[model samples]
Target chain A: MIRLENVTKVYEGGTIAANDVSLDIPKGEFMFLVGPSGSGKSTLIRLMLRDEPVTRGKIWVAGKDITTLPKWKIPYLRRSVGTVFQDYKLLPNKTVAENVGFALEVLGRPRSVIAPQVAQVLELVGLADKAKRYPRQLSGGEQQRVSVARAFVNRPPIMLCDEPTGNLDPKTSVGIMRLLDRINRTGTTIVMATHDHAIVDAMQRRVIALDEGKVMRDDALGTYEGLGEEE
Target chain B: MSRILFLIREAFVSLRRNLLIVAGAILAVFISLTLAFGALVVNEILRINTLAWQQGVHVIAFLNDAGENGVPSNAHEVLLEDVRGWDEVDQARYVSKAEAWIEYQELFAGQEELLDIDPTILPASIRIELVDIALHNSVKFRLDQQTQVVRQVTTAADSIEQLQNLSRVLNVLGLGLAVALGLSAIVLIANTIRLAIYARREEVAIMKLVGASNWFIRVPVLLEGMIEGVAGATLAVFTVWLGSTSLARAGEGFALFRLDVGQDWFLSWGLLFLAFGAVAGIVGSLMGLSRYLRDADGTGPDTPAGF
Candidate 1:
């Protein structure tokens, strides 16, 4: 459902972020993107999110050439791909329920639909009891769960997690990974970018490793490779 | 229905959370509208007073006596008849020398010593009222040409001219002050809205990421600014009304100045002030939202969106 045909991204002043990298993931597939800092992993995710344009390649997500999509239609394209961030990205002033309901609200869904949908998603993420609490009032794991609930609230076809558990403890990271796996098993594609070896080793899913703005390895049920200690 | 209500509820919640900024916006609108309303009231009073003076204007033409100028008494009568027949003249009454002197004596009745002078020394004057006070110059020119009967023409034209000049100067000064105050108010309101938006920047950013439409984000901020503006304007109008009423009451006996703060003026000014409030609110919201939208589009946080 996602394809990058020799996609290249170059920042201003001639800095190449991703150099002629190409990849493909079939529908309902689960994949991990592994790389060190400044290794172009984030750039790949940003390109997928349409936050930045590709320099000299085409990106097709859910069978639409997003490279040729009009600016006004970018938001609608984003509605089909849910994104979770490392910081949880929950609005600090809003309650857990508000943060989760925000995604549905953006879709202009009626309250009757939003309320039940948000309730169900929050329940799935085990954050139903903390719905009334603000982000500052919740722990890191709980806040991450709220973010997960928000990302999945609209039932997007694909979920992109950019270091979703980077700030959590190992046990909490495992829990988030398990939640993601549960979501993946329900027939939705999942693509995560991270450098965590333990989690990648535990998942035993397809992995794509990048080094110096180039894709170094791609394997099904692969192990973390080509990154030394202090990554 | 519930979604709209939820949006409104969220807007109010955000407003309450950012009360200090909202208060600042209200204060800016209040001060600006107060100055504007006060100027409007003063302008209205000046206009009414000018109209009254214009309507009450009369010209008095003094006739040359037959003993001094060797003009026949019949010449003076014929001149009076000619002046009376002018189309511009609304009404004319001939004042005999004795009658003019008697009127002067009555005016200075408290000073009996000055009233002993000869009444015959006063000149016979013809008082003329013009149908239109603005045609004073034309009537004056016509009377000045008749030197055989009229020695000199005196009119309220000079006084009216001076008053008009003063009113024009006052209007320019008021406009300058209003413009300066309006700019200051815009700056103050923009700052207030900026602060409110800054406080909620995280929520705004999240909304953008979630694909919220521009209107969904802008409407709340606009409503907040509008509420503050309307409240401030209403208070300002009330204050000005009370001030005008009190001033009119205090000056009733003294007659230093008179103001007609009647229902019409109140209604008109009140509506104008309300409109000012709405404009201030809309401007503030636009300023705030422009920056927010720009930042959401991946530019610097303070970049303004092109409207």
Candidate 2:
């Protein structure tokens, strides 16, 4: 579950990133955030992750007030909410297995647990055979899948994907989205931010639209609204 | 404990992958430590030689002429007895005018013609040896106050004073050179670490996003620094030992130049160099991580969703 109460964010000098927005999503629900570039969609996700502090409000993730959590506790908070970025952010020097195992290693997990858990996650992401391959050795779709494997390897309660498919072709994007859908189906709450109208309309998931730092709509099973009259 | 092992494993892997940077850092530490330890050995040798010279020499006192407040014949016997009574005085002998002339003649034997002068014209004197030549100045000062029996006192004071000044100057110069080399070593190490860090900046940012603690991120860099430092220091100690031993053996053939590198000195300096190398490595890691850690904490411009 996630909640935001009258949150606003301002960047250097007086540029508004997010302005006076509030929303809530229940546990185990999948949601899509749709907006154009610079529309505060990324800002909303950043605030939830505590990557940037809200200039003037409170944020709660998984029933804990992250806004008031100490800096030392930020790492523990992040362990419960997995995040994937537009860039896969995989270490080019590391193999697929090493990349996935890295998340658990940061958590100081035991070797006995880490070895088997990493193998299971890699297999779940359909990369069981590519575990030994480096990121550069894989295709863009496969790299994104590795990133997804890394994010979900620890089985966090919530997953946030910020334009994860932004760098791939349309076909690869579809494959990545399907992988995310499969992940969501297993009962981990998923929130993805994107500008892709076609994927949004096709998935027919709950949508939250933003325009100019304010939330414009929150619709269940919503279409990609405000996109040139829905084509 | 397992976390530490994991960190150490990662650090080893990273160091192996970046072998050239590690080598460069090691080389820097080695050269700096070698220069520093070499100077230290040179200083120790100078100190020992100076001590030997001070211990080998005795003081020489010159007496005033007869009628110029000259010492009485009986007073001369009393002065000699008093000098012999002191515990520090190993031997005291009276040098009459005739004996002084004979000693001067023997000293300048090449000029035999000058030795025929009347011995009675030479002044009376006393030759005194102390248990240790370092007490020469104190003995001279104590006897000079006896104006009734002694007029002027002179020992190897000027030579000893000059040696002391030279030692002080050499030490200061060595220290200045060591400090300059140390700073250069730090810069070299910092640059090496920066390049290594830059190569893995993406991985570091990902780790930050995944909730890795600052210590978790720092351990690898610090380990890398330690490895370089230890390797370099070992090399330096080996080189110093080899060089000193070779020089000492070579000096055996030329007895005029005695090069004595004692075992205690070698062991102590070797340990000192190793410690210095470790400190240098840690300093370099700290310098490189300062900027990177600040950026990763979200205080810098690029907040990559992880900080």
Candidate 3:
């Protein structure tokens, strides 16, 4: 579960990335964050990850007030919430398996513990056969799958995806979404920021839309709307 | 323990990734430390030689041969007494004409021609030795004031003084040069580590996102720098040891003093240089990595293309 109340993020030189945004999602919800460019979608994800500090208001993640969390404990906060980026963020030099196992490795998990968990997640993302392939050797979809596998490797209670399928083709995007949906079925809460309308409309999950910096709509089983205004 | 291995392996990988820069860093450390240690060793050797020379003949103030009884007069004895009473004079012995004759006869025993010469020509003098060699000038100046009895002051004190001054200058300049070179090496190493980290920026970012402790990401880089430092220092110590050993052996070929220093002295310096190298490497890497660690915006791609 995650909760944000009246959170605001302002960048240097007075650029308001997020303004007066608040939301709450219960456990095991697969929600899509839909928005136009510069609409605070990614900002919201960053706040949840504590990558960017909230300028105003509070944020609570998994029953802990993360906004007040000390800097030393930021890593602990991140360990509890897995993040998947749009670009896949895989090391080009590492093989798919190493990339996935990296999450557990950072957690100081032993190789004996990391090996089986990495294999299971890679199997779940359908990249079991390509575990040895480097990021450059993999397709766009495969790279994204590696990213997903890495995020789910530690089996965190929550996952944040910032446009997980932004760089993939429609068919590939669909596969990535299905992988996320499968992960969600395991009762892991997922909050994804995306602009893929086709996938958004098809999945019909909860959607939170933002505009300029404020939350515009929060609908269960919502449809993709350009401005997210009720007609 | 496994994590430590992972960190070490990662460090080596980083070092290999930027081999040229790392080599340059090591070379910088080597050259600077070599110069520093060589200068310090040379300074120590010169100081030892000066002290040896200072111990034997400090100051010799000759009395006028025109004194009555072809020996020292009351003025000569007075000068000797004045020289001996001074705090700087550790021991002052008056070698009378008779003693000088005996000493001269002993000095030229095999040379009949020099032995036939007059004993009166050998001036009775006060041989003044100082407690501290540095006070030689003051002692000589005070002795020279007795011009009526004192004929001339024979001392290599001026030469020794000049050598001491040169040694002091050499020490200051050598230490200054060493410090400057050491600092430049530190900067070069820090830059090299910075480049290495930048090359793996994305990986670091990913690590940060996964809740990796900053130390987990940084320890390997620090280790990389330390390894380079230790390796360079080892090479430098070996070079200095080889050079000193050769120089000491060569010193045996000549009649001059030996170049050999105490084994403990050499070992202590070697250890100090090694410790310095290790500390410099760790510090430089830490300084370089500090910028990245302080960044709260994880190193991930911040390109807000969409969403």
Best by lDDT: 3
Model 3 DockQ reads 0.43
Q: Residue B84 error for model 2, in Å?
A: 3.7
Clashing pairs in 3: none
Each candidate's fnat, listed in order, reads 0.29, 0.42, 0.60
Error of 3 at A35 (Å): 1.4
Query: Using Cα atoms with residue i matched to residue i, what is each candidate's TM-score against the true structure?
Result: 0.88, 0.85, 0.85
When sorted by DockQ, best at the front, the candidate numbers are 3, 2, 1
- lDDT by residue for model 1 over A1-231, one digit each (tens)? 899999988776666778898999888898998888778887788788776778889999999998888767767877788888888988888899988998888787888899899989999999888889999998999999998888899989988888898899999999999999999998889999898999998899999988767889999998786576535
Candidate 1 vs candidate 2: which has greater TM-score?
1
* Runs in model 2 lying further than 4 Å from the true structure: A228-231, B61-81, B87-138, B141-154, B176-180, B252-258, B302-307
- iRMS of each prediction: 6.7, 3.5, 3.1
B189-261, model 1: which lDDT tens digit per residue?
Answer: 7778887788777778777777776677888777787788788889888888988888878778855356866
Docking class of 2: acceptable
Across B257-279, the per-residue lDDT of candidate 3 in tens digits comes to 65876678889988888888888
What candidate 1 gets wrong by more than 4 Å, as runs, is B63-84, B90-125, B131-137, B145-151, B254-256, B299-307
Can you tell me the CAPRI class of model 1? acceptable
Candidate 3 displacement at residue B6 in angstroms: 2.4
Per-residue alpha-carbon lDDT of candidate 2 for residues A1-231, written as tens digits (9 for 90 to 100): 999999988886666778898989888888998887777888888889877777888999999998888877878888888898888989888999989998899999988898899899988878999999999999988999999999999999899999898889999999888988888888899999888888898899999988768889999999786643311
**What is residue A9's positional error in candidate 3, in angstroms?**
1.3
lDDT score for candidate 1 against the true structure:
0.82
